[model samples]
Target: MKYAVFTGATGGLGTLCVKELSRLANWMVFAGGTKEAELEKLGKLPNIIPVRLDVTKQESVNATLEIIKSYTNKLDAIVNFAGMTSFTSLIEGESVEAIEKLLNVNVVGTARVNRTFFDMLYQGHGRIINCSSESGWMTPQPFAGPYVLSKYAVDAYNDSLRRELIYLGIPVIKIQPGSYETNITQQVYENFDKTISNTKYYKKLLTKMKPLMMMELNQKNDSRRLVKTVIHAMESRHPKLKYRVGTGKLLAMLELLPEGGVDVVYKLIFGKQGHL
Candidate 1:
């Protein structure tokens, strides 16, 4: 039987992928999350073993490794969906602690889990799939500084890990998904609200940006589309190094411009007064 570990399995997209993966013949999935209730519910599903894991803590990751090791000596795949985000202007919103927490979960947490599980993956000659975001490659948005920074780090981390592991026959793949209908939007909204409430100098600017942020959030694509790409990355014999799903053409076009040209476009969008 094939064995796999899925972090953030309680999340919207992660839950979908875990359920779909459970339907595969002879496949066993260790669905890792910190939520006890959700993990218990997921455990009831066929071929799904729910594991309580907090990627931010090394002890939790080690415990999860022990739990999975008890069931199997090798792991065919490790899909990292465990991540967090913070939406705030770097200069005026969100505390340093909040930014550090975001980086810990989204970047360090991913590295922690992957490094912890590498031995089992090596034993099975498995693949590692990391869920980055379109923001990882796209130009930075106004209020999403912390999140964008974390994803950019993920992009770099994955590239470095992939290069180092390729010679060992371990494929490290990256999934850079566009906005998907997920709880991340809700979290972003909450963070945005906090930013607005706490800002001293950017209140007007944030107010102007609110409508645009709402519009972008509301336009998220169905997350199942992204899940399909995750499945492809998992099951394919030869998956591409990167799978980009539902990314925006405008973002792509903006990226094609010169750095100064991109800055000019942003200036026009938000106006000289910082009103969108």
Candidate 2:
């Protein structure tokens, strides 16, 4: 039996992926941070079951895996999309909590998902879809340092995991999304003022980054950006190991370029002094 499981199903790309997964898999599990009401509503569908699985909690992850195991020894695909954590440019010591939370949820959470679900993939001979970010390649805006770090770490680990899984004949795929229309930016906005107001080092540029974050806050993701990749990763006979969506070929080329070249390009764009 083919099954699909999704985390972060409450909102953003996760919610959209859950909707799509419902169409493809015989059974679907929706794991969320704290959106039980919505999950219950989604779970009401004949094939969909909403399970509370906070990626940050070991027991929650274990219980969710047990539910999947009970359904079948095999899972077609698992979307590790459980994260609401972000970082503001300012390191207000207060940001430490969020920083830790972001890493714990995104990096450690992904590892936990991979570990718990690999057995099902081995059984069904399927794939693991990890939602990486353009941030995994580069940090564009300020005050989002921790998010960039965590994503970068996840990207690296996924690459390694993908390689290891080849021996098991289960593929691990990565989706690198550009700024999509999602609730993530709202979190950035909510923390924008407090994060900057609490810091003194980057005050001169605070007003500058305001518009950037505000612009980002009001933005919404093209659900298609994520949907298309999720489908390709699941359905295609030869799904790509990495999917880089949106923003045309230029950015794709940029991500492909070596890191030193990328740094030179960044310096050129920002006109910053060379340090290396």
Best by lDDT: 1
Per-residue lDDT for 22-92 in model 2, tens only?
76545455455457777887776556778888887889888888887787778888888876556565345
Model 1's number of clashes is 0
| Cand. 2 TM to true fold | 0.84
Candidate 1 lDDT by residue in tens digits, 160-195? 999999899999999998776688778889988998
TM-scores, all candidates, are 0.95, 0.84
Q: Model 2, stretches more than 4 Å misplaced?
A: 25-27, 30-33, 139-141, 216-221, 247-276
* Residue 128 C-alpha lDDT in model 1: 98
272, model 1: CA deviation in Å? 2.9
Give the clashing residue pairs of candidate 1, or none.
none
